[model samples]
Target: MEMRAKKSSRSSTSNTSGSTTTTAVERKEIERRRRQQMKSLCAKLASLIPKEHYSSKDAMTQLGSLDEAATYIKRLKERVEELRHKSASARLLAAGSGTRRGGGGGGASTSSAATTTASGGAGSSEEAGRREDDMPPAVVEVRQHNDGSSLDVVLISSAARPFKLHEVVTVLEEEGAETVNANLSVAGTKIFYTIHCKVRTYVR
Candidate 1:
């Protein structure tokens, strides 16, 4: 009976040892797999970052440290934002320049037109003096689009005499322009006229 009891105890001890060994091996395998999965995720993250943002000489070196990879990603985001801001500012500046050019062109045209009218209407030396005193200085500007599809004209003058707006419209129509819109405003002694028109490319 004593020998049987000792054999049974020995067998129990052997079984427990074998079970402990198996459990230890399984735990080790699980830990190894977890580490491999983490490494794969880090590699994927590093690949997504731009090469310019990497601080290391070799891009692969950045993947070795999680903190470095994260820093590169942050820098990439900031660079994108800075580029976006610069693009927006450039567009705004271009728009402002276009507006100013349109306004200046209109003013120049109006002034030229007024000068030509004044010169041609002066038939006699005595009449020239009277006409000059009666007619306010006029400015007219015509701006054509790059496509040659449309034009905008602006006229500004001091109301010295009865300045006819219809005469200007008639001249535009004769020049093969279809009036789209016309605006006229009188402020004190000043007259402002803005006309939007489409130019006819072919005679129809």
Candidate 2:
């Protein structure tokens, strides 16, 4: 009878230990899965921010490809308007035709020309808009993919945090730019990442 009791006690202890080990293993797996899920969420969220558009205004004007004659005509139109504004036809030359600067609609006509100082109003506002249209967008294309194969992208990201290397990789991949290599640097309060990627040709 004592032997039976000892055997039963051993079986109970063994079963309890096995169950405890199984529970520990299950808890560890659950933790790993949770971590993976959280990381995935972080990456998805990071990919939404847009990249800064950087370019020179002069470079954009060159892209317009205006013919030389058309460019000259535009210059002539602006000059005529300047002359009209100053009332500087040969008739108003005594008022000081102001040595032909030939651009920028003349500064306010001479105060001595017997005219009150002009104040810009709604007409000036519209004229300002017209002048602004001549300015180019902030960014220009430094490179573009071939016509048979190209990709474009927009992204949004959290403003509060700096991304890890892998996180940035995830974002670029999402943009369809596969990463070949990366170089990085740090400046006060900012991080700069440079990436090199091969352009893909879509044969299909």
Candidate 3:
């Protein structure tokens, strides 16, 4: 970074004078500017120091008198603030036009999509999760043999819910669940089955 700064400054102030080297006056001015730049850089670095740092009283006593340290710190802080003010003023001066990002200085930049999206607010993610939970459990299939029987009855009946084995079996029977075959399972939940129902069907 220092090399880049030096190179830029050197290029900005070319030393050429009828093919001769830089004059003493120009060289002196450059050195003076360099010192000023270094002082400004030091001020910026000093501002980053945390305020109100603590040290053990015994350690501080061993190091130096608190009064002297405080004086030094106050000077550093004042210098940093002065430079920050200067930088802020320069920025304000350079900002001739209105604020960009398609927004006025005090106004927010909002897209049409963002304005229309009241549905997906703070509760949207939770609502989506709840919708997933509310989805109906899949209808288990139960195929029947020549003799009327189905796995559907056994499956729903075993569930520890409003539906039980006997209750579900009754439902399937009422629904004309016939040509019943066995059910399938995974770990615990009854997942799949194959059953042929009567021609007419109605949801309970």
Candidate 4:
């Protein structure tokens, strides 16, 4: 009876030991797989960033790629915001111009009609004036901000004319203005140009 009991006890101990060993091996394998997954993710992140942001030393670490990716994302966000602002400004200016042209047309027609009632001579003069106002060669308007730190140049020109944009840019460059952003749009036979410039740049 004593020998049978001892054998039973020994078998139980061996079984417990085997179970512990198997559990340890399984845990170790899981940890190794986790590390491999982390390394693969890091490599993928590094690949997404520009090569200029990475160097020989940056590739060796686990967190280096993450940092570079974060910085690149930040710059992209800033660029997007800048473009949004420029687009908004362009739209506002265009809208304002359209409103002015509409209002001017309304006023001019009323005034011309009143003048037409005065005399035959006045009617002929009104026709001449209408022709002159209908087709202006070009109009350039420079508007400076109240703070004097920046300015916007608006140019409206006939598409058929020889008004080159580069000439305006050259003039701005010579006048100590740094061109920040520019937009061009065409409407019918006319071209609209809006250039934003910095006022406090190097003057030479």
Cα lDDT tens digits for candidate 1, 113-173: 6667665533443464576567555666666676657878777766543235566666667
RMSD of 3: 31.2
Query: RMSD in angstroms, all models?
Result: 16.6, 25.8, 31.2, 14.2
Give the whole-model CA lDDT for all candidates, comma-separated: 0.66, 0.44, 0.42, 0.71
lDDT string, candidate 2, 1-204, tens digits: 999999999999999999999999999999999988766654443333222221223322322222332454566666754443233122212211222111123333432222443554545645755754553322111123454133222111122223345544554454445667766565554444455554444467
lDDT of 3 by residue, 44-77 (tens): 5444444354343432331333443565677786
Judging by TM-score, tell me the better candidate of 2 and 3: 2
| Residues 1-204 of candidate 4: C-alpha lDDT, one tens digit per residue | 999999999999999999999999999999999999999998888778778766557655788777778888888866764554455445444544454444536757866667667687577667856764676656767777876578888878766442455656766665667789989999998889989988654469
Clashing pairs in 1: 109-140, 109-141, 110-139, 110-140, 110-141, 111-139, 111-140
| Better model by lDDT: candidate 2 vs candidate 3 | 2
> If both were scored by lDDT, which would come out higher, candidate 1 or candidate 2?
1
Measured against the true structure, the TM-scores of the candidates, in listed sequence, are: 0.40, 0.26, 0.19, 0.50
**Candidate 2 lDDT score at position 16:** 100
Quote the RMSD, in angstroms, for model 1: 16.6
Off by over 4 Å in 4: 104-204
- Among residues 3 or more apart in sequence or in different chains, the pairs in candidate 4 whose N, CA or C atoms overlap within 3 Å are none
Ranking by TM-score: 4, 1, 2, 3
